[model samples]
Structure formats: C-alpha cells, structure tokens
Target: MTAAVAQSLSSLLQRTTIEDHEAVLKSCNAVLAKSKSDTRAQHVKAVALLKLDRYEDCLRVFEDAGDALKQSAGLEYAYALYKCGKPEDAITIVSQLGAGRGAQHLEAQAAYRAERFHRTAEIYEDLREEHVSMSNEENDLRINSWAADAQLQWKGQSDSVHHTKATRDDLEAFETAFNAACLSLAKGEFGQAEILLTRAKELCRTSEDLTAEDKEAELVPILVQQLYVLNKQGKQAEAQALLEEISISNISDLSTKKITQNNVILTQQTSPNPYVLYKALNASPTPVDNDKLFEFQNNILVGNTHTADLLVRKYDGIIRSTSKALSQSPCPSVSPSVNLLAVYNAAAHAQGQTGALALKAICPLLERRPKDLGLALTAVQLYASTGNTTAAIHTLEAFLRGLEESISEDDKDARFNPGLLSVLVSLYKREGRTAHIRSELAKAAAHWRDRSEPCISLLQAAGTSLLHSSDRADLEMAGTLFRSLHQRQADDLFATAGYVASQAVINYASIENQVDQLPSVSDLVADVDVDALEQTGILPSPGSVAAAAAVIAGARGKRPAAPGDEKSAKRVRKSRLPKEYDPAKTPDPERWLPLRDRSTYRPKGRKGKQRAADRMQGGVVSEKVEEVATTVKSSGGGGGGGQKKKKKGKR
Candidate 1:
C-alpha cells in the first residue's frame, strides 16, 4: 500500500459513496484514465455508468473490467440492461443471482417495469411471504411501497384488466389504487380514476392510526380528482353537491372534542380545504359549539371522517364551551381574518337556512371589514338573493370603492373587477334606475370589453334602456354603443338591432314635424323597411287612413287638431263612417238642417264659446251663412208657384 496505491483505493471507495451517478462516473473515469490496468477501478466505473443511466456504457466498462467479480456486479448490470429495454438479457443475468430476497426484489422490479405485471406480482408476493418473519419492519414497508407503486403503474398502463375486486385493507392496496387513479386521471380516463379513488378512500376510512395530516393528504387528492371527474362528466351540480358533502364531513370530523385548540387554529391556518370552513360556518343546529369548531378545524386539517357525525355533535358542545370562555375573558383585539371567518361562517349558515336575522346579524361585522373580498362578495350575494337590492348595492359599492383606492396597477384585482361591475349593473336594473344603469354599463364596458359576461350584460342593459328612451340623442348613443359591442359580441344581435331601429324611429319622429327638413318618405322607407315597422307594430299599415293622416299631417307641417275642437270632432265622427258614405254626394245639404234656430247652436262650453267668438271676429263666418241660405232657395223650385198665387191674391 504505497502512497499512490492507497490514494487510488481511497478514491474508488469515495466514488462508490457518491449518490449522483454522473459525478461518480466522472471521478471514476478520471481514476480509470490514470490507472488503465486497475480492474477494481474499471468495475467501479461500470457501476457509476449504470447509475448514470448509460447501460451500454456500463456493459462496456464491466466487460473491460474482466470477470473477477462478475457474480456480485451481475445484478447491477441486469438492472441497467432492463432499463435500456434489453429485458431478455436482464432476465438471464438476474436468474443467475441466486435465491436471495434482494435478488428477488430486483427481479420483481425488472418484471414490473417490463410490463409483465402478473410475474412481478408473483415475485413481490413471494418476497413479502419470505420477509414476514424478518425483524426489519422498515424494509418491509419499503418493499410494500415499491410493490404498490409497481401495481399502480401496471393498472394505469393497461385498462383491459377487470377491477371488480374490493380493495384490501393493506396500505399497499391503497397506495396502488391511489397511484393508478392518478395515472388514469393524467391520461383523461376520469371514470376509471374515480372508481379507483373511491376504493382507495374506502380502504383508508377504517385505518385507526391515520393522523390528521395523513388523512388530509390522502383525502384531498381524491376529492380534487373526484371534482375533476364530475366536472368532466358534465355533472356540475353533482360535483358541487359532492364538494358540499365532503366539506361537511371534513368539518365535523376535524372539530372533534379530542382536538387541541392550538391544533384547531393550526389546521384552520394551513388546511387546503376551505370548503370545510365554509361548511362548518353554514352547518345546521345553530349557535356553533366551540368543541364542534375545534373538531371541525382539526378533522378538516387532518382529513379524518370515520366518526364525522359524532364529531359534529362534539363540535356543538365545544362551540358552546368556547363561547362561554370567550365571554368570560374576551380578547379586545382579534385578527381580521378571525373576525371575517366568524362572519363568513355565520352568513353562510344563515344563507343556507334562509335565516334573514342571522344574516343581518353578521352585516355590521362585514361592513366593518370591507377589505375582506370573500366576505363582501358573499354578503352581496346573500342580500341580492333576498331582494334586498339596497343592501346588496351598498355592500358592492363599499367593495368597489375599497378596491379602487387600494388595488394597484399591477394587481390581479383587475381580473375580478368585472364580476363586481356586473353585480352593480344587476342592482341598478333591479332598482329601475335607468340613468345609473346606463352609467354603470358604460363604465363596465370600458373596463371589461374582453370579458364576455360583463360586456354582453352591460351592452344588453344599455341597449334596452336606450330602446325605451324618449331622447333621440340617447337613442343614437345607444345605437352606436350597441353596434360597436355587436361587432365584438355577435350573440346580442337581436337586441342591438332593436336599439338601432329605436334610434331610427326617433329620427323619423323628429322629422315628422318638418317634412321638408327630413328625407322623403320613399327615401326614408328605403332606409327602413316597412315590414320591420309593421312587425314591430310601431308604424301603421300602408294605405290605411291612419297612415294617410300621418303622411298628410306630416307633409303639411300642421299639428293635428285636438279632439275637443269642433272641426276635429266633426272629422273624427265622419272618419268613422263606412267608405260608401260620401259627404260630397249629398243632394241638398240644407235639407238636413237643424230643426232648432241658429241661436240653439250658440256656444255653451268654454271651448265652444271660444270657437263662436273666433267665428264672430272673422267676417267669413257671416258670409258663409248667407251663402248657405241662397243655395237652399235655389234648390226649392216649387216655391215659385206659391209666390205667383200670393201675388194674384194681393192684386
């Protein structure tokens, strides 16, 4: 053992100890390059190559190392060969490693990786049975973990295997099912994954030593996967329902009496399942017990649900105790999250049961903490559902004002603002405040044009309000707004077109009084189809008397007479006559003269008096009366003989 030889031996031992194969390989290669005849260095280099995942290089290095320790290095060579897809060669080498448990395990892993699942299972079973009496429990657990991992991998790789058997109580079975479910999920086989996960959950349910953390880790994955599966199946309502159930179960179990208070807070702080908190807050059997809260928080954090119902009862008791404790020595200051959590729980429970008083009780708490976005949102929702638009709007405005002041330019709050904007629009609509509604819509559109929900909703609100507005300018503004929005949101075409048509009607009305100032009827008609007008039931039918009157009145620029006017009254009565009755064809107009004297026709009412005074003020009225008498005498020819006989009698 000279200095250089001793250094070489030490270097070889250090290379073998290095976990990183590439580093080991590099170091071993350096040693091999310096000592070409060192067979031991060559063997170490081959093992390094094997670990580095370069199987062919490992084989070359092993062959060049010579046959001095081939039996001992054979297992490593076989594994490297197996990984390189040379399973036949791996099998031949592994078969010669003798009947040791380590050899069997290696062979099993190789068979599992090669897709020979049944053979791998047999090997693992034999290893387990042989190692049952072994004192190394940790080794057994590791072997079981490996076998389960392999089984899960196998199940995932092949879907043709029937999985009807109930999962065994062994941890290995659950591990296999979990891994298989995960693999199936990754491959978009949600149905198979869900079944496997459900089985895994059933297996873990009865495990006595399962800790809160373990339960949490175990169940969270399954629930998340279940959610994914249910959502993919288009069973959204069912998924939501399942989420609710899981939340309730988690809260009940975690809040058991046995859970420590510190553990409760820790669990509440770190738990990924917020739904449990949500459920606990909303659970029935009012006035949440402290014990129940404690248990709920614990179980939720831990993922235990074996005795959820009992835990829920215990939770009720704990809540009562905690409330008494808090009352005895009230903390003057609590974290905002804690207060908000309390309010959230209360509000959620109130909302679930339609407990209006309970909801109102939490409002002050929520109002005081407007910074809590979740609390604010839930409050708005609950108020809105109850038709308390005022309260809802107030809560929403508080949130918006807070956000506007606090949210920064780089914050992600911009993505969430549109939803709040939509809620504002809904509130205004519910209040029938068209002006506020339009303003909110415009603001929303400016901010949320890319978000289809808010954009479409705002456009609809604006278009509807504009359609019903009397102002031409407003209608035109609405039309322009709708047209711009329509390009982006084609689904709102019907509403957009209605707004445009409304603007057209307003334009038509404006021009009605100044026919010369407006486009001609034909031109206007060309721009707007009469059929559309008819379909909308806004314009009268073509050629109808009403239509004629509209056109005549429109053309003359004369306002139609009021109904109380004598001439308008007469026209209205005459207009009601059948088409066959022609006033122009009357033989003697005076033959149907009034039986009473002209004094009888004297004005009686204020309107009639005004008409007579105007007639008297105008000399044409007296001349028209004389003309009517002279025309009547000319029509009476028999009057001439009566006049001649009267003249003879006088002579």
Candidate 2:
C-alpha cells in the first residue's frame, strides 16, 4: 500500500497540464482512500487542490489531514482553513496548536478583512504584547509591523494604548499611523487622522533607528496627506504651519527615493496623489525649476518670494484638507495611473513656481522615462533661467541632433513656436554674446520673417552702433552685413542706413586728405607764394659761371685710386744684388758666398784666417772649407761648394 502511494505521488508530481491537475488530485485521493489514514498524502492533495483554485476540495483535504496528523499540522492547517473562509475555524486550529503571535496576526488580518473591528483590535493588542516580549529584532519588527497594521485598521474598536518606544525601528508604527490617518480622513474623522499623522511625524522625527533618508520617506507622504486633510477641513493656517515646519532635508531625501521607487508603492496603494505630491513638494528647493516657478517665485533666485511661499501654503492647505478623503474606511489600493497623474501635477506645480524647483521635481519622472519631451523642455527652460546657456543650448541641440529621424517640422513648430523662440532670443540677448544673439536672431528671422519685429530690432541696433562708431573697419563690416540683410529683406530701414553710411564714408575718404592738408599748409606757408615762387630763378656772373663749369669738369675727370696703391705706387724697389760682384770667386749655384770683399766684409778676421791656414796645412783643405761653410750656414747663408756638397749628400 505504501509503495502504491509513493508511486502515485511521484506520478502526480510529474503531471504538468491543467487537465492533469484533476488527475493528480485523483491519484492523491486514491492513495488517501485506500489508506484512509495517510495525512501526508492528504496534505499533498490539499496543496494540489489549492493550486487548482478548488478551495472547497482543498479545505476538506486539510481537515482530513488535520485529523490524521493529530496536531502536527498547525499553521499550515490554519492557513488552509482561513483560505476556505472559516476564520473562526482557523482561529480554533491555531489555538489548539499554540501557534502564538503568528496565529493571532493571521486571525487579526482575517477579522480586519471581515470588518470585525473589535476582534481585530483585540488580536492586535495581544500581538503587540508578543512583539514586546520577543528579543529577536527581526521577529519583533515583523510582528510589530503587523500589529501596527491591525491597530490602524481598528483604531476605534479597542481601548489598548500602544506601548512600543518610538525608536528608529518604528517604521512599521509610522506606517500604521500613516494608514490610520488616511483611514480616518476617509471616514470624515479629520481630527483623528490629524492626531495619528502628527504622531507618525513625531515618531519619524525621534526614531534613532530610522535613517535620515528613511525618516524622510516616512514623513513626506504622511505630511502631504495630513496637509490635504487640513486643507479639506478649511484649516489653511494649520496646513501652512505644518508645511513650514517640514524639513527640506527630509523632503529632498524622500524625493530622491520616490523617483527610483515611483509607481511601485502607489500602484499597490489606494491614494498615490498624496505620496506623489509629497515627493514633488520635497523636490521644490532644487535649481531645476526656476523658470517654471517664475510666476510664483517672482523671478528671483536668492531670496524667498512671498508669492511662492503663499502658493506653497495654499497647496499644502489643499493637500491636508483632502487627506481625510484619501484615507477612508477601507483603504483603497493606489493605482498606477493615479500615481502618474499625481507626479505630473506636482511637477507642474513646481514648474509654475520656479524652473529650478520644477526640474528637481520632474527629474524622477524623467529618469523613469527619458522620452517625455515636456520634462525635457522644462529642464531646458530651467537651465536657461539659471543662466546655464551652454546647458540649454546643448539640450536644444541634442533634441535637434537626431539619432534616428529628425523631429517633424510640425512638431518642432508646435513645441518651439514663437513664444519659445522669443524666450530663447531674450536669453541670448541677456547673455550679451554677439554671436549667439546673431545666430538666434537669424534663426528667428528665417523661421518667422513674417513677424519681422525681432529681426528688425536687432538689425536697427546693429546698424546704429556701426553708423555711430569711429572705427571705419566696423562701419565697413556693418555695411557688408547690412547689404546681406537687405538682400534678404530689401528696403529695410537699417539696411538703408548702412548703404547711406557706406556712401558717406566713401565721399569723406576722397576729400579727407586734401581737407586735412589745407590747415597745416596754411599754418606753415601763410602769405607765401602765388606765381612768383614758381617762376623764381638764380642768375650768375661770367667768372662764377666759368668757375662752376671748371669744378664740374675736374670732378668728372678724376677717378679714385684703388685701396693700398697710393703709398705703395710711390715707393722705389731696390735691386736685390749687392754693391760688389766678383765673378772670379763664383760660388756653386746651390751654395752661398761668404761676406768677403763685400761692404764691411773682409776675408775672415785674423783668428779665423789663422784657423783656416792651420786646417789647410793639415791637408784638410776640404775640412777647413767645410767648417767655414757650416759657420756661414748656421748664420743663415750657404757656406760654399763644400757645404753644398755635404747638404746634398745628407739629403
């Protein structure tokens, strides 16, 4: 029997088709029928039936499983019974199993769903005690979150006061208060909602466990709802005071998170407007919506504008006053569409006040969807308002520079139109960049030549400046530009002025040099010459005339001597030969003669002659001669044939 049951279970597990769901159920039922005591198989059948939405069949299986388990199946049985619409039966089952807080929470949820407010409150009170007793932080938080939800759902049904400390982990508590406040507002219980929302705000403020970011997230939606309720109740002053008290830091954090979590929470909730409005309100201080907020902020960026403050007050009043309506008896789930609309409205409101604020408000929306041209335009305009011309220009250029097809002409016209163009032109003018101004003017002229006002104004100003300037270059350039303009728009006033200036300049140039010379000439040559100076001549006597002619002839005939020739040409050259020449005592051609018989030259002195005689007597005539020759050569002259022969041999 057990083998058959196991096989059937395995087969059931393998079944996939919806048609097979019944077969799977039948197999499990067969196993249970044969054993009539297999709780596990019965439980399996119950789960299978539940999957098929056979709630009645599943409930019967769970009951039989419970009987077989004899107390083992506690929470599972209770859940199955609850799903079968037997909350009381589920509650009894949980009690029998001693399921504790989980059971109570489930029972409370069932009671709340059934509109048994008193029972729900009672269960929540017990659950709250269970949460306080538990030491595990995660478990405590989980149970407390449910407890808060229950208490909020049944706020007037029980007399139990909340005992949990307003610690940072009181997120669930704040959520509870937020819901209760919303509910009270829905039920026309404005005062009660106000109290709960105010408590929620206080808890958010004091909770140490709540991060600044988390606190902000908790505060904004509650505050916005409270503001709506207050507004609906005609408590303008109160609403304004509450809004004024809201920390901008908190708002900023909430706004940032909302952008990322957009539509997720609101899509599941009943009232998204309050939450979205909260996000927008928080984002109001950013620099993005300055232009959008022009009317509200009075075009001032630094100081607070009374008008904007008042607008904020009015909006806050409206929000607080409507909070009650949003939080009616049974809280409705928030729809995605309502959330989206609320975001749009908030962004619009922020834009209406200041472009900077509007940008911050819309950034989240844009992040969710970059193709929203309205948001793109708003961002661009805000950038312009903040004097971010480069950013604005780039944004426009990006839109114009297509990654795909260009934006249609009609769409461009619809978007940029005349008003936007005017704004762009004005911005360019304000920046005082001539090139940008010119480009923008030209663009405008090309697109809207029929209007002509802006183009005409720019042209007139440019022409006037050119005409009045002292720089002729400037005038010339302007004239050329004017001619171009005239070609585009004939007979334009500025163009006409340019043409007249050009002509006047030409005429002035022609007469200018002559006119300027007359004064200087008058200063230097006053009363001087008429025809007398022109006919003046110099006459000379006959002698003077002849002298002048002679001088001229002399100058023509004379030529300058070459360099170094004047001194050297007058110097006489002496003959190189000595005064005495003796051919009989001829020296060899390659040799030099001694200074003997020459002026101041005698045959060598007595001592030299004695030495010569001794050398000859020794039969050393050649030697004596050679010695003399060496002496002479050492003195820088050839000695004679003997010396010559010796030199030749050495070489």
Candidate 3:
C-alpha cells in the first residue's frame, strides 16, 4: 500500500475504536480516495453511516460494500427496516443473520413490531435460559417477555405481571417498568400500571446518560400511558392535569411523535374532535405514513400537486399488485393499501387536500370487486375522505341496495358488518335523513334480534332518535325499544338512560293528551252528570249528588281550576298574606319566602371545628384567647331568626 493510504487506514482504525463516527467517515474516505478497492475503507465508511443513524445512506454503503456490512451492520439494517415500519422485512433480514444474542434480540424486537407477540416471548424465553444471571440484558429480556404476553390476548398464561418487576439499571429499569406496565394495563390493573409508568418516568428524568431530547422521548410515552391509565380509572381531571407537564413541542423526533400519537388514540378520550385535544394530548396528530404513502402525502402537504398526482398513480400500481392476494386473505385489515388509507386520508386532511384523490387507488379495485362490502365501504371512505360525502353516501346506498337483493349467503352477513352499517348510518345522520336512519336501524334490529352487541347499540340509538319526536306513536315505539334493551342488557347505562328518557317522554305525552281531552271551564257544568257520578260512587252520597249539580253551578266563585290548570297555574300571583290576614296587622316577615328559604329553617350541613369553651353549651366564660374567640363567635351571632324580631322604633 502507498504511504497516504497507510496513514488513512491507521486513522480509520483509531477513530473507529474511539467511536468518532464522523472522523472515521473522513478517514475511510481518505483510504477509498487512494485505493477504490480498499474493503476495510468501504466497511468502516458504512459503519460510520450506521452509527450516525443515516440508515438510507448506510444501506447504500452496504450495497456497495457487499458482505463487509457484517453482522452488526446487518443488525442495523434490520433496525432500519423496523424503524421504517416494515417489521416483516425486518424479521426477514434478522433471520438471515443466523442466531446470537444480538440476532435473537433483533428478531424479538422485529417480532414485537410485527405484533407477533408469541414469537417475541419465545425468543425472550430462549435468551433468558441462556443468560441465567442478572444483567441489563436479562432485565430487558424479562420485561419484553412480559410485554409480549400483554399483547398475546387470549393466549396469555398469567396476569401476575406486577410481581415480575425487579431492580434494574436506569434505562433498562425504565424500559422494564414501561413494558410491565403494559401487561398490568392489559390485565386491567390500572392502578398498578400507573405506578409502573410513574416509576418509568422518574427513571427517565434521572437518567444520567440521556440528553434532554432522549429524556423527553422516553418520558412522553410514560406520561401518555399514565394518562391512559388515568382515563381507564375514570380520573379525567388527573388525566387532563397530567397533560400540562408534557411538552410535545420539544419532541422533534418522528419516532417519539409516532409513539405519542399511538398512545393518544389508544387511550380513547371522550372527545372525537382531535384538534381541540391537540395541545392537551401533547400527541394529537395527523396520522403519519411510511415511505409508500409518505411520498404521496408529503407531495400533497407541500402543495406539489403535479408530483402528488404522479405519486397518486403509484397507489394504482400497488392496488393492482396486492389487491388480488389481499382479497383472498381472511383478514381484510391486513391489506397494506387499505391500512395505509387512513394515514393517507389523515395526512391529506391536515393539509386540507380535498378532492377525489382516492380514485387512483380505489377505482380499479372497486370496479373489480363491486359487490364486495369491504371494498365498497373502502370506496365510500375514499370518496368521503376526499371531501365527496355526497358521492360516498350515494356509493354506499347503491351497494347496500344491491346487497339487500344479492343471493349469496356471505352477502347477507356482509351487509350486516357493523362498521359498514355504522358508516352508512353516520352518513345518513349527517345528511339529516331521519327516516333513512329509522328504516336502516329498524331492519338491523330485526336482523340481529338483540342477539348481538351491535343490535343492542343500534336499538338504543334508534330509540334515542325516535324519542326526539313529539308524536305519541313514535314515543311509544321508542319506549318499547328502550325497554327491551334495558331488559336484555341491564348493566348498560346507555340503555337504561335511554329507557328512562323514552319512558319520561311517553308518560309526559300521555298526561298532556289526557289533559287535552278534559272539559274546559265554560263546558264543565254542562259536561258533568251528577246522577251518573252518584251511582258510580264518585260523589259523596245521594243527597250530595243531588247537591252536586248546584255545587258545580256556583263552584266558580271567581275562577275555578279545570283540567290542565296546573300548566297555566303560573298566571296566578300568590298573595303573601293569608286569606284571614287583617290589613291592620303586619304580616309574618318570612311568609312570602319559600319554605326552605324561610329564616326559621335551620340548615344541617358539614360540621366545623368548635372551641373547647364553645363545646361547653352552658356558655362558660373564658380568659385571654379563649375569651376573645368566644367574643368573636358571639359577635357573628345567630342566623335564620326571621330578621331578628326587633320592636319598631317610636317615631
């Protein structure tokens, strides 16, 4: 080798050893400048790029260096894929690197991202058996094992995640508690979950190695998980108060931002309006996309219409490639393009990108799968997302009408997909088509026959909507629906609330209608049959019945109360004086006041501290401070004594 290349190789070794990635990059570049085929230079340069977190650049260098990227760089490659949200690809890459501590850890991490919770647990288990001693890695393995179990859903073996926690190093401890908290939360031990998350936050805050950015990145997720626990515990005030301590503005890192957003949505706070909660969440965000949709969304966000249009066609190619395979898959949710649609729609909304932008992606697939309810709903969402609600509603209605006539058994169940029905119902509601909602929900209620949760929910919704009507028939129907729902699901507060409201409306209407049928004051004497009342025992006796005719005749002394008089009773002004009050004598001071407001009312409420001297009701005289306290208490004097009955001063 030449002297210059030799010097460069020496410098690269020195810099690489000390982990000065930038310096290592320069030294590697120096060697590669002198001899283009220097493999060491290429490898060191790639390592520098990976260490700097220039993943794309590192990948490019890996491509150029071939096998020189080595095991660690291969691990970095998998991590880069994981970060890019291609967990399956990450797992594939990690699997290709054979097995070891790093490879197994990488595979487990990738599996976690892919939501292969069981696989993650298995990998952690293997690692645990091999290590056999306490270390940071062991803590991490234990934490992640529990974390994976948390998401194993029905397959989870145990709920004793809280007992698994043990002392660990700062970052390892934070991660442990954070993961354990997830298991706790999954088990519905929200109080325990909250404690774990708080512990995680403390570790993050006190971590010596982490920078402010790092602390914030770790701390925000802990706070967000804590917020979720608070919500689950119904401590809404504490959740809102918790929001104040988070500073999303300081979180410039996209991964952290994504974490925050995920937690915010997962928490499911009451408000549907994300913008109102944007700052409060410290995480409320427009859904972000990976490279596929990001290219299109970024173009739209920056007003690059021409590029966005060109990029929009990319979805067409993706649809053409994946739609057939994905349609055959059992789970529609796993469709890549369909899954990305939400992120695409959200990104477009944030930029106010209103148009039929979904046409490129949805049109071809929709045309091919015209009768597919999932596809049809996706099409509707596409139109709706692009600010074409009218088109969306029309599209949905046509699909529903067709499915209503289809001969296939699957079609029958497909039409009843709760999400599909919900979208249609919500669409109709938005358009203010009360009749449509009533018809649709009524059909769904009959179809499910209260055998399903969706049926019960739709029934309650239908009942609530019908309860708004003033018609007696509608009110009665609503009451019936609510009554049935209350019977079927007694614990459903919403159903119970709806039943109460509907019953109230029905009862009120009945009372009002009865009042409406009653005779008016002018017709009261003509309408009364005194002899009939006497025979029916409604009158006092036969003599009274004979007198009843005369009784009702002059019964209107000045004004007589008739049917529905209570409704109009407000027209009468009550006199403060009693009927026998003499004008010469003054009236009782509190006669005009309400019974509760009268001075004679002695309110019983929470007790306050009483002095020892005051506790002695015999009015014991005291000395010094006790005497002063007594004097002060007496000065305030008694209350509720009808304005302290005082003799009028002589004029």
Top candidate by lDDT: 3
- Please list all clashing residue pairs in model 3, or write none if there are none: none
| lDDT (C-alpha, whole model) for all candidates | 0.56, 0.53, 0.63
lDDT of 1 by residue, 63-104 (tens): 666666466578777776676656667777889878876667
Q: Which ten residues in a row have the lowest lDDT in candidate 1?
A: 287-296
Could you estimate the TM-score for every candidate?
0.30, 0.25, 0.43
TM-score of 3: 0.43
Least accurate stretch of 10 residues (summed lDDT) in model 2?
A: 289-298
Once superposed on the true structure, which residue ranges of model 2 sit more than 4 Å away at CA? 1-37, 47-57, 63-74, 99-101, 111-158, 163-167, 172-174, 180-651
lDDT of candidate 3 over 1-651, digit per residue (tens): 586766667565655565578878887777777777666667667668767878777667666666655454677767767666677988988888886688788888877766566677788888888855555676566667767776663233342222344455523578877877876776777888888788888888988989987887778768867876887788877877887777767766565554455445434456655443443433334443232223222233223222233243334433343455444554324233344443333333223333465455555655565565556666677687776788889988887777778786566666665557788888887778888777776666556655544445566666777777777777777767866776776566566566566666556653453344434667858878877765554545554544565455445343434657675365533475357867588778898798655757654543322343345468755466577887678767657464577789987
